[model samples]
Target chain A: MTPTIPILRVRGHLLVSVQGELGDDVVEQFQNDVLSAIERDRGRDGGLLVDISGLEVVDTYVARVLADTAAMARLMGRHTVVCGMRPEVAATLVQMGYMLDGVETALDVDDGLDRLGLPR
Target chain B: MDPSLTEVLQFDEHQLRTRLAFFRIGEEELDRLAAMRPLMEEATAQIVSLFYEHLLSQPETRDFLDDPVLVDRLQAKQTAYFLQLFEGRVDLAYVENRFRVGAAHERLGVPPRWYIGAFDRYLGLVRERLIGRGVAGAELVADLAAVERIMHFDAALAIDAYVAGHLATHARNQAALRELASPVIRVHDRVLLLPLVGTIDSFRAQQVMESALLGVSEEQARVLILDIAGVAVVDTQVADHLLKTTAALRLLGAKTILTGISPQVARTIVELGVDLKTLHTRNKLSDGLELALSLVGREITDKERGS
Candidate 1:
């Protein structure tokens, strides 16, 4: 059984930190939850921050999902920023040919929030 | 040279003797050894013969004796070595010879394990001969104890030399590999070239960042051309490292321009949906240089002044 990833809302912004290896189904479910949470909040100015700092390696599947989430968030008028991409993980991702298109990245959560310019 | 090897070479004969002084190997023992010269001479031939016979019996030992003539000569050399250990006076020549012997063993690819094991058999043979001499009681006990110290000290010197040589070779290879893998070269007055040639793992990636950054600061380079023509893969981890390196260079007031990203890498990045738009990139080194030159207010106008 896959543990559902929690998407927390702070100051109207949705923050989803992927903690471990997520199965494709779990990632898809998380994506749906994120979109639903954004709609429920009904705050178009608020953005989504997907943190992948906890991940050691983001495979081709994970990379695609992350990219799509960014695109979908944008479509919903939410800015998505990826935070805490480790140096080694980034290198491996690039080596594996992941450009992480449309995913704005920051060093950490604080940096992500700053980039998003959210209140409080 | 490796620091360990340098340390080993520094232990001269006087120092080594003093360090092993706990065994009470002094002038009195030398006198006793000289007094037993006849016994040493009488036992050497038989000891050498027995030593070779024992060595030849074991598959591990027989491998060292590749040529019959060479083995015969080594047996004679072994006889001299056995006699020299009990020859009264410990001199620089003795330690020097031991070092040469160690160097030879290293060349022969004879690991220390084999030689150290062989010492035990040599000591056993020597003990047998000492006992057969009928030199009994306290005298025999004292003589044998002294003989053990001499042999142990001998083994220490040889093994020390062997280890030193091995470490030196190992250090050399490590340095060579480091140079080949991570190089930060200055191509122009303010532009640096880092041509990554091998697979970039996390460790190498970190090293690349460190050395490249150091070069940036040291050379005061305005632009770093990261040429990955030789790099075969750029997994997410590798890409992350590249970005991190670029970010670091940015902090130092230097711009990082990536070049030589092949079609497969490009396809992989696009397929994975990685956004590399934030970085300044060019298809080739020449294109990157053109941009770098422009950044420094230098332009390459055609010499003919017309197409």
Candidate 2:
């Protein structure tokens, strides 16, 4: 089983970069970790930034989990932003029929942070 | 049909053969074929040589037999083909062989017209030889009729092969064109540009939406400029497709600016009752770019002002 993606707190936002392959266990762990991190950092309620640039492939199931994670985070008062999807992965995910609806996205961690952390 | 391409095209060979029954090959033709075997064995080598001589001489068919080595190889195959053809050995294997002949020619860029023309040459020679052997008027006519039926069957099978090849090529081209149509040009760090051209259909509309949403997220674009200046027509579905793409991008925290909407397109959108209310529309890419720059907190100033 691959290790759980690391969740870091940078200036109040929860930052997670998904690298390599995520096993079934790893994705389940990721979901639990992000949810708990939001709960742990309650006072600030800073956004969540999930960067997937390290991934070469992302299947529909994984894409669904990412979207679900963002939606779950949003209900907890923390804005969840997904960022850094590779072009190949994006094309594949689109082909796989994942729209990633309502999940905030940005080019990288910096862009994602601004999109989520700052007001529009 | 090559089974793989046939599977994709849903081509039915059994049905095709049933349809080709109009050419009329039967037991009587098979009997005539058996009668011709001894003579065909003697004639096969010479006829194969003459057939290729005619093909290689023609500028059109010559290209199909360009390599001298390949021509030599084909002459041997054609010799064996004719010998078996007259021996009444057209079982399942022979039918399959006939299909392969057509497909092979189609792949090598040999037109069916040439194959039919080759039959004309073969028939003319066969008439001369049968007459030389003392097979007279009515029997010769019957023999010729049987031969004609078989050649027609061969020609029809070859046409099926050609059609299948073209269908496969057309499908491949469409897939390539879709990939080519959606190009995401990233102009700035936080800005992405999409210039949509040509007629938009529901299929391509879905393509555009998927492409734009994914591009916006992939590039982390804060602003997207969708320029539709070259698009000839827009209807309700197209308007809906564009709106869905914009909405998806907006939720991804990207602002979308629809630029290059011709006066005609804008009227079509409004008349069709697609709300362009939420979108920031622009007449030109320059205006769209300026707005995108401002959205990303940048500005372009004249050199004279600083000087």
How do the residues B1-307 of candidate 2 rate in per-residue lDDT, one tens digit apiece? 3354344444466754564466777678878978988897888777778888888898988877788899888888787766765765445455556667777888877777788899788767766777788878889888878776776676666677678777878999989998889888999988989999899997887788778868776666789999988787877668767876776666455788999987777887787775556678889999999999999999877778655
lDDT of 1 by residue, B119-138 (tens): 99998998898898887999
Model 1 docking grade: incorrect
In order, the Cα lDDT scores of the candidates are: 0.78, 0.77
TM, chain A, every candidate: 0.89, 0.91
TM-score of chain B of each: 0.69, 0.76
Clashing pairs in 2: A106-B220, A107-B220
Off-target runs (Cα >4 Å) in candidate 1 are A1-120, B1-8, B184-192, B197-222, B227-254, B258-307
Name the weakest run of 10 consecutive residues (lDDT summed) in model 2 chain B.
Answer: B1-10
RMSD per candidate (Å) reads 13.3, 6.6
